[model samples]
Target: SQQGEEDPQALSIQEGENATMNCSYKTSINNLQWYRQNSGRGLVHLILIRSNEREKHSGRLRVTLDTSKKSSSLLITASRAADTASYFCATDTTQGGSEKLVFGKGTKLTVNP
Candidate 1:
């Protein structure tokens, strides 16, 4: 959980606005994935962008991965109240000679109608 760091730990935006969250990592990764957790539910997969791919989009979500900078960003356009949740960026990274999926603390987003 320490391998990745996310900025703007909390964000509030009006419905239909765009919410952008950024994440930075410490080590090399293969596939960077974004997830959304709503309150008590488990993590829900949002998008997965490979290191070779610069950008990927799914529905209103757009994800960008930059291996060079060791960073990634998740953008939600036309945001709705349903989008209110904690978004986290996870990466498969090597640690202590073993590779594991590590997730950032996450950015809690609140979309108001």
Candidate 2:
């Protein structure tokens, strides 16, 4: 089954603007995390919000989780060209006894100078 899906497949913005991304998932999750990927590189963990938590912030990143809706949103403040990358939301799920992080398709963000 699909774990997570993100909306607005792609976005373009100017530097200093704010970028918002949303993710929707199915089933219960232990924790949700957001990551950023620069083109052909690997993903870098941004923030993680647990099932008990409603919102979290890290530097220029803000994340909100709504368990009732099985949805999460990530907001990036003062976007820069360096922030232009693919953002993804992942969910932590346990199967059998181990936990794993399942990632969504991701939203591609382009910040133009």
Candidate 3:
């Protein structure tokens, strides 16, 4: 499928711990992005990893892409209670000449303080 697929559908951890999520897709993509969404709110773009890029980091967030495996992983270091949210991996894919961001179901993370 052109849509991304995230694994370990849900996760729970204590504050100050680390969180890791993985995503896989079936088609080629120009870039893959990770997003975080708090409950009842819109998504916030975290980072984008281009097809040619291997890894990227922002603050406490780290993202990695392996184009050969069509997979990506997102790591959050020293997670806080505020980090509790649903995280999604999205890719820019074209369908019928129109480009769209296809997102995975997402992994819901629960951070307990």
Candidate 4:
């Protein structure tokens, strides 16, 4: 099974400062995705990086993957209060003739104004 765990379970930063979160996973995966959830709301997809790619960016969000190290990192540039949310990294596990997404514990980010 492919499972992921994020580092710095909780982080607090001031507005305009960049925030970084790291995730590590086991086994093989086809792609790694980052998602954000504000409070009790549903998840909002941030970005997805394929196995063959090393890094990707979308607006203020950036994601990097290292298959050799089985790790990934999410960086939010120019953070804002609205960006305060729980970030999660999900990996697609394709093994045993089946595929499923395994999510990490998540990192809680707080951007103070």
The C-alpha local distance difference test score for the whole of candidate 2 amounts to 0.95
What is model 3's C-alpha RMSD? 1.1
- What value does the lDDT take at residue 78 in candidate 2? 98
- Candidate 2 colliding pairs: none
| 23-107 per-residue lDDT for model 1 (tens digits) | 9998889789999999999999989898899999999999988899999999999999999999999998767888788999999
What's the TM-score of every candidate structure?
0.94, 0.97, 0.96, 0.96
Model 2 segments more than 4 A misplaced: none
TM-score of 2: 0.97
Please provide, for model 3 over 1-113, each residue's C-alpha lDDT reduced to its tens digit, 9 standing for 90 to 100: 44899988999999999999999998988899999999999999999999999999999999999999999999999999999999999998878898889999999999999
Candidate 3 has an lDDT of 0.95
- Listing every candidate in turn, what is its Cα RMSD in Å to the true structure after a full C-alpha superposition? 1.3, 0.8, 1.1, 1.1
lDDT of 4 by residue, 11-96 (tens): 99999999999999988899999999999999998898999999999999889999999999999999999998999999987868
Tell how far residue 30 is off in model 4, in angstroms: 0.4
Of the two candidates 1 and 3, the one with more favorable lDDT, higher being better, is: 3
| Regions of model 4 farther than 4 Å from truth | none
Give the poorly placed runs of model 3, Cα more than 4 Å off.
none
- Candidate 1 regions off by >4 Å? 94-98
Cα lDDT for residue 95, candidate 4: 68
